[model samples]
Target: MDERFNVELEQLLQDRGRDFLSLSGVCKVMPSALRARLGLKSNSRVGEVQKALQPHMGRNLEIRKAGRSLCLVRRGEKDEMLLRSVQARPGKSPKTLRNSLPFTAAEFLRLTNSLLKEGRLRVELNARCEPLLFAVSPEGPPTLQPQPLALAPVPDAEAEKAVLRAAFQELEQGRIFVRICDLRRRLGWSREAFDSALARLRRERTVQLHSGDVSAMTQEELQDSFVDENGFRMLSLTWTEAR
Candidate 1:
C-alpha cells in the first residue's frame, strides 16, 4: 500500500509542477469519478495520508495542514519555497501570496525585493489590475538582471501590436494557444505595457485567453498567467483576426 501510494503521489506531484497540491483530490481511494486518480483515503483508517507523505517530507515536499484541507507545498530553500508558491498559485492579489507564505509581512517584503533585484522573481498586473508575483527562474538565482522589463521603452499602439504579433509568431510555433509567459518574455515588454496591451486586445475580442491545468505547467509558465478582476485566470491565448 505504501509503495502504491508513493507511485501515485509521485505522478500527481509531477503533473502539478512538483509544487503544490490538495489532498481533496487524492484523499479517497476506489473507482469513482469524484476521486482523483492518486488515492489515499485517510478516512478509511487503513491508508492515512500523513503517513504516506511522511517519507517525502523534508526531502522535496512539505505537508501544509490548513484547516481540514491538507495541502502539499514544495520544500526547499526559503527562496525556492516562496518562489514555488507564487509560481503555482499567485491568487488574486500580492497580499494573497504573502498571506500564504511562512514569513512575516516585513520579511516577505524584504525577500520579494531581493528576488526582484536578482531577477529570479517578477511582478505583474492582471486584467483586474492586481499585482502578482511570478518566478522568472525556478531553481537557483538568476545569473543576470533582465533589463527588458525595466529598461524597454513603452511601445506606441501600432508598435505594441506589431511587436505582439512578432512575439506570438516566435513563441506559438503552430500551437493554437501559446503560453502567455513565453510571449511576454519574447516581447521584452514591461509588465505594465504587456498587461495593458493584452487587456486591450482581450476587451476588443481580438484574442481569446484560456486557462489550463496548473499542475501540468512549469513555475514560470504558471506565473505567466493572465488573471482578470473577477479572479478568472487565463494561461494561454489564441487569435484569429485582429486589427
Candidate 2:
C-alpha cells in the first residue's frame, strides 16, 4: 500500500506542478476509482499520512509542515519561484510574500530573514516605513539609502505636547496601547522628530516609553528602552496624567 501510494503521489506532484498538495487532498481524489486505487484512508491523520509518504522523501521532492497542513513541492522549485517573484516585483511586503507563497506569517519571516542574512535578499523601507524585500542579483541592485539627517530637527515643544495628548486620547479610545512606529507614521513625522518629541513628553511626565518586550512598566522604569540591531526602535507608550 505504501509503495502504491508513493507512485500515485509522485504522479499527483507531476499533475499539480508547482502547487502544494494538502494531505487531505492527496487522500481523497474527485474520482472514487482513483481514491480507492491510492488506498489512502479518509480518516487518516496527518501523521499517518506523513509516515506513509516517508519513503518518497528525497532530492526529487520536499515536504513542509505549516500549521496542521503539509505542503509538498518539487525539489529546487520554490527557491527559483521566490527569487523570480522578488526580482519581478521589488519592494514586495512580507504580507504579499505570504499571499504569494505557501508559507504562514511566521514561516515567511523566518525564511526571508534567513535569505536576507545570507545576502540573497535586501530590504528597504516604503514611504509608510513598512519594510519591503528585494532580490539581490549577481551585479546587485543599487542601494536605496535613507536620506541623511545632518542635524536632526528639533520638535516644537507645544507641538510635542499636542502630539502626546492626541496619542493618549487615541489609545484610550481604541487599543489602550500603541507602538512607537505606528504613532510616528500616523503623525507623518520622521523617526528623529518623533523621538525628540517623545523625549520631551517623557521628561515632563506626560508619557513613558517601554522596551518592546515589556508590555507594561512603571514610570520609574521608562528609561530602559533599547534599539534593536536592525536600527528599529520598538517601544510601547503609556500616557501619564500631569500631577
RMSD of each: 7.7, 13.5
Error of 1 at 74 (Å): 4.3
Stretches of candidate 2 exceeding 4 Å from the true structure: 1-4, 28-34, 41-44, 84-92, 95-124, 134-243
Model 1: per-residue Cα lDDT at residue 47: 33
Which residue pairs overlap in candidate 2's backbone? none
Candidate 2: worst-modelled 10 consecutive residues by lDDT: 215-224
Give the per-residue lDDT digits (tens) of candidate 1, residues 1-243: 345545455566676455555544344422342133333443533236555556645455566643234556555576776766665443224564665454557767888888889887877664445565667755665332332232242447666666677667767787788888777665544556678889888887778888776644443455456777678888889975653
Q: Write the per-residue lDDT of candidate 2 for residues 1-243, one digit (tens) a residue.
A: 355545556677677443455655565532455455444576566676666566666556556653445755455555565665566445556664566455667756777777788788888764466676777867765542322221223346775576556655654566646766445434434444556667766777777666564323311122223243456544777776652
Give model 2 RMSD, 1 decimal. Answer: 13.5
